[model samples]
Target: MRMNYEENAKIFKAVSDQSRLKIIDILSCGERCACDILEYFDFTQPTLSHHMRVLSNCGLIEVRKEGLWNYYRLNINNCNKLTLFMMNLVTETKDCICNDKSKCTCK
Candidate 1:
C-alpha cells in the first residue's frame, strides 16, 4: 500500500498555504462556486484563482465550469489516499507490541 512521495508532497504543498487550507475546509462540506469561495476571504479574484490553480494542479481539488462560474470541490478520493498514506507512515508497525522486539513479525 505504498504511495508516491512526489504526489503526496505536492498535495501537502498545495495545502501548506493558509488561504488554500481554508479553501479546502470550505470545500469539505460540499462543492462551491468560485464567487462563493471568494466571499469567505478578503483577497481579490485573481488571488483566489491562483490559490485554486495550485490546489487543482496538485490534484487536491477539482474544478468544473458552469456558464461563467467555476465550481470547486475537494477531491475526496485523493484526500482519503493522502490520509491513508499518513496513517500508514505513522503506524508502520501496527501489528507489533511495545514490549516484544525479537518476537515481532509485523512486517
Candidate 2:
C-alpha cells in the first residue's frame, strides 16, 4: 500500500508532543474515562481536552460519551496503518521514493 505523506505527517506531529505520547500510551491498555486519564498527569482538564482533540483529529484515538463522561481508546485500524507506514518508510521496498531517479533534483 502507498502512504500519504501529508496524512502521516499529521499523525506524527500529533504524537510529537510528550503529553500526547503519554496519552496514547495510556489508552493502549483499553478505553479510559477522561477522569482516569487525568490522574496520570499534572495538567489541567483543558490541557487534557486539547491533547484529546489533537489525538482524535489525527485519527489516533477515538472518544465516546457515556452520560457526562468521555472515554477514549486507541483507534486500532489507524494505529495499524501507522505501524505499516513506518515500516514501509524505513524498509527498502521496490516503490521506495529513492528508487525514483527522475524525482531527484540534484544530478
Which candidate number has the best TM-score?
A: 2
Model 2 TM: 0.94
lDDT of 1 by residue, 1-107 (tens): 75577888878888889999999999999999999999999999999999999999988899999999999999999889989878866674744344367877798
Error of 1 at 33 (Å): 0.5
Q: What's the lDDT for residue 78 in model 1?
A: 84
Clash pairs (backbone) in predicted model 1: none
Separate clash counts for every candidate: 0, 0
Off by over 4 Å in 1: 94-107
TM-score of each: 0.84, 0.94
lDDT of each: 0.88, 0.95
lDDT of 1 at 44: 100
Global lDDT for candidate 2? 0.95
Tens digits of lDDT, candidate 2, 21-87: 9998999999999999999999899999999999999999999999999999999999999999999
RMSD of 2: 1.2
Q: Please list the Cα RMSD from the true structure of every candidate, rounded to 1 decimal place.
A: 4.8, 1.2
Report the C-alpha displacement of residue 79, candidate 1, in angstroms: 0.6
